[model samples]
Target: MGSRLNPYLSFRGEARQAMEFYREVFGGTLTISTFGDFGNPDPALADQVMHSQLETARGFTLMGSDTPPGMDLVVGNNITVSLSGDDADDLRGWWDRLSESGVVSVPLEKQMWGDEFGQCVDRFGIGWLVNISQPQS
Candidate 1:
C-alpha cells in the first residue's frame, strides 16, 4: 500500500460526535478510542474520544480526536485545511454544511481565478478553504 494523506482534526470535546457524523456523511468504517483506553483513566475525560478514524468507501480518510489535557484549542487563525477540485456541486454541498453556524471569510462564489472559492471557520473553530473549479466543457 502507498502512503496517504489524511486530515487530523482536534476538537475540545466533540470529537466523537464529529467523527460519527463524518462516518454518516462519507459512509465508512470508524474506529474510536478513549483516554481511558490509553491508560490515562482520567475520569473526566475517559468518556471523551481520544482518537477516531473514518475510512470511507469513497477512498477518503479522516481522523479526529479530542484535545489532550492542556492543549490549546484555538480557531480561525493558525491552520486552515483546504479542499480544491473541479467538483463544483459536491464541494458546494460541503461548503453549505461547514459554514452553517460558522463565520464565512469568503462566500462560495466564482472568483477572478475562475474558480468558486470560500473560506470559513467551522462551528468547531476549524478553518477551511474550498475551491471548486468549473468543469471543462
Candidate 2:
C-alpha cells in the first residue's frame, strides 16, 4: 500500500461510539480493536478502543482510538479532519450527514473563494472542514 495521510482522532472514552457514528454518516467499513484484544495488562482500559478505522465508500479514511491510561486527552484546538473534493453531490451529502447531529460552526454555502465550504464540530466533538471545488468555466 502506498503512503497516505489521514486523520487519527483521540477520544477520552467514546472512541467506539464516535467511530461508529462516523461510519453511519459516511457509509463505511468500521473495524475496532480494544485494548484487551492487544493484551493490555491494565484491566481498567481493557475494554477501551485501542484502534478504530472507518473507510468510507467515497474513498475517505478516518482513524481513531481511545486515549490510553497515561495520555492526557485535551479536547479541542488540537486537530480537525478536512474533506475536500470537486464532487458537489458527495461533499454536500457528507456535510448534511455530519451536521445532522452536530453543531454547525459555518453553514455550507458558496464562499468568497468560489467554492462551497463549511466547518463544523461533529457530535463527537471532532472538527471537520468540507470544501467543494467549483467546476471550470
Candidate 3:
C-alpha cells in the first residue's frame, strides 16, 4: 500500500475509551489490541490498550495507544504524526531524514508486532512514528 500520514493519539490508560469515542464520532470500524494480546505479563498493563485504530469511510484514519508504564503523558504532547505503509525504501529514507539531528526514542527496526517501527521527535519538537508493514509470508 502507499504511504499515508495520520495522527496518533496517546492516552494515559484511556486509549480504548478514547479511540472508541472517536469511532463513534467518525462512524468507522475500530480495531483494538490490548497488552495482554501481545503477551505482556504485567497484570497492571494486561488490560490496557496496546494499540487501537479507527478508520472512517471518509478516509480518516486514527490510531492510538495507552502510554506504557513509566512514560510521562504530557497533555499537550500526547499527539504524534504517524507515517505508515508497506513501502520500505521510502519509509526508511524518511525515517533517516526525520531522525537526523533529532531524538530517537525508538530506533527504526523490527518490532515485536512484526513491523519495522520506530518513534522519534523531530528537531522541531514534533513527535513522529514510522511503521513499515512487513509482507505476509
- Best of the candidates, lDDT: 2
- Per-prediction TM-score, please? 0.85, 0.91, 0.56
Kindly list the per-residue Cα lDDT of model 3 for residues 1-137, writing each as its tens digit: 89998777777887886677556544789999999999999999999999898998768798889989799877656567778899898678878877887799999999999999999886545577999999999
Ten residues in sequence with the least summed lDDT for candidate 3: 17-26
TM-score of 2: 0.91
How close to the true structure is residue 117 of candidate 3, measured as C-alpha lDDT? 97
- Tell me which of candidates 1 and 2 scores higher on TM-score: 2
Give the poorly placed runs of model 1, Cα more than 4 Å off: 74-76
Candidate 3 residue runs with Cα over 4 Å from true position: 77-137
Q: Which lDDT tens digits does candidate 2 get at residues 1-137?
A: 99998899999899999998888778989999999999988999999999999997767888999998678888986787888999888889989988888899899999999999999988889888999999889
Q: How many clashes show up per model?
A: 0, 0, 0
* lDDT of every model, 2 decimals: 0.84, 0.89, 0.82
Off by over 4 Å in 2: none
* CA RMSD of each candidate after superposition: 2.0, 1.5, 13.0
